[model samples]
Target: MEVHPANEFYLQTREIATGNVVGCAGALEVVPVSQVRLPPAPVLDVHAYLADVPYTTSKEARRAVTSSQNGIRGDAGVDISDHGLTLDDEFPDEFEEGLVQEIYRRLTRTSVSDIPGPEPESLVLGNLRQFFQCQAGEIDFKWQELYGDVVRFKGPFGEDRLLVSDPKALQHIYQTSRYDFAKQAERREVSRLISGRGVLWAHGHDHQRQRKIMNPAFGPRETKAFAPLFSDVASKLGGKWKDFISQSPNQESVIDMTKWIGPATLDAMGIAAFDYEFGTLDNSDNELGNVFANMCVEVFGSLSAKDILRQALAGYLPKAIFRYIGDNAPNHRLEQLRKASAVATKVAKELIDGKVEALEVGKGKSDVMSLLVQANVSEDESTRMSEEEMIAQMRTFLLAGYETTATSLCWALLEIARHQDVQTKLRHEIHRKEREIRERGDRGLSASDFDTMPYLTAVIKESLRFHPASPSTYRETMKEDVLPLLKPITTLSGKVITELPVPKGLKVVTSINGYNRHKDVFGSDSHVYDPERWLVPGRIEKTAYVGVYGNLLSFAGGVR
Candidate 1:
């Protein structure tokens, strides 16, 4: 038998040389059978040896070893050198074969299909432009066709290469906590236009510090204190809607609930978070409130010339000029943004300064803003926010409390309206809880009360999952490395097969809508609005697989 040199290591074993040899009295001593003639050895090749192995190749061998050590497999293979044979010669059992086949099937099933043949770069760019211009309703279908579930394109206005609609890949992306991924420059510009350099746009330590200071504002006690405020605002808005509907006889007046709720929630945020009022709930045209509302409408309405110019000179222009142009463009809408930011900031400053003065004067105040002021001033270390930082923190709280919650509520209502059964179920749950609280003589529902309403909470959760207002998030890879996507992908031209090689500086845009509706993870009815799915007794397995936004990508992932 010709021995391959590679197998020489396995062949030269003590057991094969001598069955038993006495060392001194009864002790066994290993002896080499040098005189024994061995068959001429065959040249050993690592590639050939690896090819003959049960795993197909050494790459698979390495993967198996890694997986086994990581507890991803049950057992290590048995040693065969003692039996004068190599482990690679042994065949796998039928069960093991079936298991391997099943795993491969599952993996192949989830693998991303090759992107169709590479068209002209201009074609891709044109498609993207058309996509951006498309109505919200038309976007989903068009996106699905262009890139079935995983698509990558370079940013139209920046250095970022964007990846769209790969949930498992998104999960891995969001797991990193280094704050390396951040809002794109365009998004930052937009946020600044709306909320200044607040927590929404802050990075690193500054963001953490701001979040700490702002925590108390959203604390259970603080949030519950604002429950009456929320009820008041909701009631007022409800009454206005009722009156408007009553006045419109015969023909129904089609109000954009989206437009109506923006101001109402703005009013709620002012009163609940800052102990002030936008007076939007009272139907009063408060200048600040009107300016803020108009700014939001205008900013979102159409891309301004300044926006176009900023996009054109993304990396070339100085940051200051970009911000200035964004804040003070030639358009009146831009002027409105500036005015809104100025007015809101001025009001926040006044509130903080007044609370500080009142506290110094021995007067007492216990609202969220007052508490924040107290906290901000009392720390020896790690407790201080600069006046500017305080302003940013307050602005963040205002935006977070107002915009996010209101958007969530709006989507929830819209979903509930469309699915009457779900609406009825949620209403029943809410009414039941309210009745319980009333019977127990609790004057108002607390944060804990909200927690206890499982069905209501589920409905909110489901709506958030379905219609996340910010449907996509952007990130830039900070380091150069091969990023193996959770799902493997074949290239459009069939030249390259990869999971996804996300090069450094590539911009990655995660699609919350796609991930939330992933069929593999969430099942066939993933697209449907079904709060009942979350109401099961135990934790939902599918939801646990989510990597962003507390296992959902509704909220922006990472620090920001």
Candidate 2:
């Protein structure tokens, strides 16, 4: 139930204290609904903000640009790396950023009638509602269909934003040039608030360093080793459900699967990732569970105007202003966000030292957390991760891994229910596979065993396509670049272009669902949930280097 405040998903802390500060667990800080006001983006003075900072060298210039965001020395000073997005890294570092911002302002303020998109509902709100549909839920596929693969929609305060699903463009954006486009500054700031400077928060070299060390523990080999742990969690969940049914006098009850599924995934992540048991499945750990559930309800459950404005401001406002709102703002959503994170932070701290010690003594469990601990203790001192960074990764995995897995599983189950034939077919395949394994004298599925069943794999892939956990990823251009398109389209001004020229600071939305269901890629029946599509050879068109699996953008390429 814990919602990630990353893009309406993650919230990183400022002045993070390593020491535990105990509060009333799951306590609600009630604030009047009317007290919440739409925060205006700060119109900061360029010269005044930059005047006092030292900028003699290239490094100092970049530092000043990052540090001066606070109208003082800003601390969250990570920069988007020049990794995949083929950004021009040759520019002089010792340059005035104020002039750059002013130029960007003029360009953004100028007319952009070249790109085609739907009209906005309001000048102030822009196409935010349409964007929200794509991000939160109720994806507006009609826009892509009408405006072609690339649509230039309005962002907050009527700034131009691009919604793109073209294959070549996606390749350029996600793979060919990943570092050029990073999770928008606001998204990173929010993630930092929630998890500190973990992999999710770290980008560029920091991200590469963190991912390199932890990648071993998340690979196929490690996953196969933990299959038994997953089986145990599933068995526990099934027993709990059985008890629920038995307690009913009618012996049948309409149970909310979400209520159970959320906690089940939490327990799974706890054991698999950290080797810690949250006991949320049976409702024993209500402190963390209730707090997270309340946060999910408050943030994701409804489209409150207040919460919407908070998220919208993140999209348009400067990082300094956005972080200010995140840290100092008064709202029910933030209260629950802080509370849930506080409780989780307490748990992560409790687990960190033991994980380190266990690994040091060579008695550590081969869980991902332990691997990270081992990595931290690596002989290469320069590459080792700090305990704080380790803690951030733990929190990152929980927020990113747990709810997302449960939600996807629930979606898979829902899809199965919707199509009875698929359910029956999937069940038959699973039974046959299990029987085959048992006949070989094996008791249950290993992670490798599951891979051998083609149909089950298809069903899972289909579910991922149909209900991608992350519907879309928000990105910002660090520099001006041309996005090449696989399919060309005419602009509003009647110019046919194969490549799109995006200016600096342009906000682009890489549409996962749009690409997943694109007619050219997935065929005319892309919108349909047909697992048989995978069964039929050549039914799906493969786009090179887009997603981590099945040519889908679910595992979004380019975290930076």
Best by TM-score: 2
The TM-score values for the models, in the order shown, are 0.70, 0.77
lDDT (10s digit) by residue, model 2, range 1-560? 22211111111111212221111112112232233222222343434422211122234543643453323122222221211111123544424344434422322221234678888878777877656644443444888878888888886667778888898898888887858888888878878777778987887888888877877777877878788888888988999889989999889988887778888888888888888888998775567666665355465555554455567777767778877877778866666666666777777877887886777677887777787777776789656988888888877777667767878999998998899999898889889987898899987778887778898899999999988987888888898787888887776656576776666778888888888888888889888999999989889888656887888888787554
How good is model 2 by TM-score?
0.77
TM-score of predicted model 1? 0.70
Query: After best superposition, candidate 2 residue 338: deviation in angstroms?
Result: 1.1
RMSD to the true structure for each prediction, in A, is 13.8, 16.8
Please list the residue runs of candidate 1 whose C-alpha ends up more than 4 Å from where it truly belongs after superposition. 1-127, 137-149, 157-160, 239-256, 302-312, 362-368, 375-381, 399-401, 481-484, 492-499, 536-540, 543-550
In model 2, which regions exceed 4 Å deviation?
Answer: 1-112, 133-139, 301-306, 315-318, 377-382, 558-560
Q: How far off is residue 174 in model 1, in Å?
A: 2.5
